[model samples]
Target: MTDEASAFVPGHVTGFFSVERTDDPTTTGSRGGGLALTDGVRVTVRPAEETTVVLDDVGVEIGAVDRVLDALGAQATVIGETDLPIGAGFGVSGAMALGTALAGNAVFDRRLLRDELVTIAHGAEVQAGTGLGDVVAQAAGGITLRLEPGGPMENRLDAIPARSRVEYVTFGELDTATVISGDTDRLTLAGEEALSTVVAEPTVSEFMYAARKFAREANLLTAEVRDVITDVSAANGEASMAMLGETVFALGDGLSSAGYEPQVCQVDPAGATLVDDRDVDGEITGRSADGSE
Candidate 1:
């Protein structure tokens, strides 16, 4: 078996989404539009006596990651790193699951096809209630339009085929399960309107406009994010709130030009991919430390 393997999965931020739920986990996901960021997660899998999961050096019990490992039927040490904050609309949980699946497949010689691996990770996310379309979006990259709601194999997706400099700042996190499990009729309706508007135009500027409208219509934007968006817009930059979190994302150098020191990254065109692995002769030097996800 390979000594270890690594994979990089992009962080995703949903601009607007319509919830779609079903009995089958594989068929359950969200119909949404979002951007995959270059500032994302990188995961490495190595053989270990027992299963262990760490994100940013912190050991966290991620149910989705556990489900992915269980599906692969392998116990290994997984180390994930990302500057993006989890539960703040950055798709950290989904990224970790997808990254682990990609790396563990090679580390354990599972040989699961990429599609199958994505489905596994997507299913895990859905079942765990950690995410819906993020795994799929992170897999596709760029500005993704989730045309249909399902796992990777069961879903339909398209991208804007464009890229831009992305900047973001998070005020805090939101409980996704609390929001998605509640009455989504209003949210869904507003989301559909926003999605339609973007689908018609399908440009970065339009996307930001539609997202801003969706946030207002759906009543999902926090005051802090709202102020941030206003600031960026006043600076003549496109900005909007990220769905399911108190995050403000802007195109180009909106945040910087607005005098906000937000994290900066670009739209990741490649999405998730496997990085080079370490050989048995050496070891992966990502030391385990205490931290949060």
Candidate 2:
């Protein structure tokens, strides 16, 4: 019996975070986390002759998926695809890991609980140093507000009302591990302040404004990013630099006029979901939500 499942997750922008570490393993997670974006990653799992992972976009080996398979004591071929640029602060790595864990559990017939799967994926990301609170935020979906952090269930989450359009431009990539591992005292303080300010208002405009302040105070904005933000602002649009990447996310039009085409997306309200590939009695038999088999 060959079973298959697929999951799609939205990307996120972490305005700021207060990191925490623990040897207890069970009680480990981040704190004071931030928002989720609309564009993200999708992963598919199916039985294979051997365990393997293929990232369709970058063609790279996914250690996070490999780690999940190892922990579950199951082998499957996993495929991840993302329109969002990797390592450009789109939270692609976290989305990939979370989607893989969810889809692989279904393909392996593990029957793992939602929180359990999130823990596995979240742990893999933390160990890999690819992200901190992305797995949690993506798991919750929408414009997430992570009040407290750890894993899926362990984190306290809220959401702002979804915006109509979210747009972004990518010029290059940044090493997330290097940036996250650095001294973040000032960044943490700035993030805390931004979090407090946004929590009071909690509008998309306020969030973006707070995020831009955090970027400037955290010293994460590059010259190119700053220039793009300035140009977009001059054109009467709100924009902010994505955390840990050299990418700018603008809220409206006028970026195209600045010689940069923006990729427009909407907020994904649903987090990860299992794709029904119903193969019954050795016969492919299943009707999709749209009444297609």
Candidate 3:
């Protein structure tokens, strides 16, 4: 029985923002928040020797994995997996990376801070381009507002408590890389400007509202995306797409619409953990820590 840890999937608002390109990523800040929902991915880590590895839907990438191990001078294998829909604007990759990295640290018997873990994960995403500033939201969970040009280099970690419950209504997969690659310059500019606005006055509700308005004005939302979100809203859920495309998110809960059994999730303040007994069975057992039995 190998030791391991699993982290809960926290819904994150994967919205786009502007930045301040000052050759300093830390100067960046998030302009707004977007629809964040849950994807099922429980990242796990196992230790063997002095090495770290990451596993995911797109197979394993060892570059960042090795960097983490080398940086810590520790020995371990980091494993990550996400049933969380890929390209759904849910930040599955970022979550997977962060979860796997933490697992590696644990396996190596190293107790690094969450901010430290976030830094490493962000670096990995930057290299992979598999994510945007979404890594910040995914790592911090709840309503996370990141400054433009965010990264560990910038030392940015801001948590915004959501005034409302936000969820995502997924329609189809958005090719994240395609959107990013196709409009690199435009998006970068947009992101930078948005960040500047938000950094000046960062508030979850204000930022999100402004972001949604900007998205509409910029025609960033595709016809299909807009229609889906509109239709879903009539049934009682606010819907929005990921940065470029690929995933749509629906906010709020208790929604009963046909063809969609909206998954119920909330902000997981407790990021990730591991259970010693993997053999535990199907019956509902423990009560929620909040005593919501």
Against the true structure, whose TM-score is highest? 1
Per-residue CA lDDT of model 3 for 159-181, tens digit only, reads 55554444455666766556554
Tens-place lDDT per residue, model 2, 230-263, is 9888887778887779988866554765567888
Q: How accurate locally, in lDDT, is each candidate? A: 0.88, 0.74, 0.55
Error of 1 at 160 (Å): 0.8
Best candidate (score: lDDT): 1
lDDT of 1 by residue, 2-120 (tens): 88989989889999998889999999998879998888888989988899999888999999999999999999999998888888998999999999999999999998899999999
TM-score of each: 0.93, 0.88, 0.72
Which segments of model 1 are wrong by more than 4 Å? Answer: 277-293
Error of 2 at 123 (Å): 1.0
Total backbone clashes of candidate 3, pairs 3 or more residues apart or in separate chains: 29
Name the candidate, 1 or 3, with the larger TM-score value.
Answer: 1
- Report the poorest 10 consecutive residues by lDDT, candidate 3: 284-293
lDDT assessment of candidate 2: 0.74
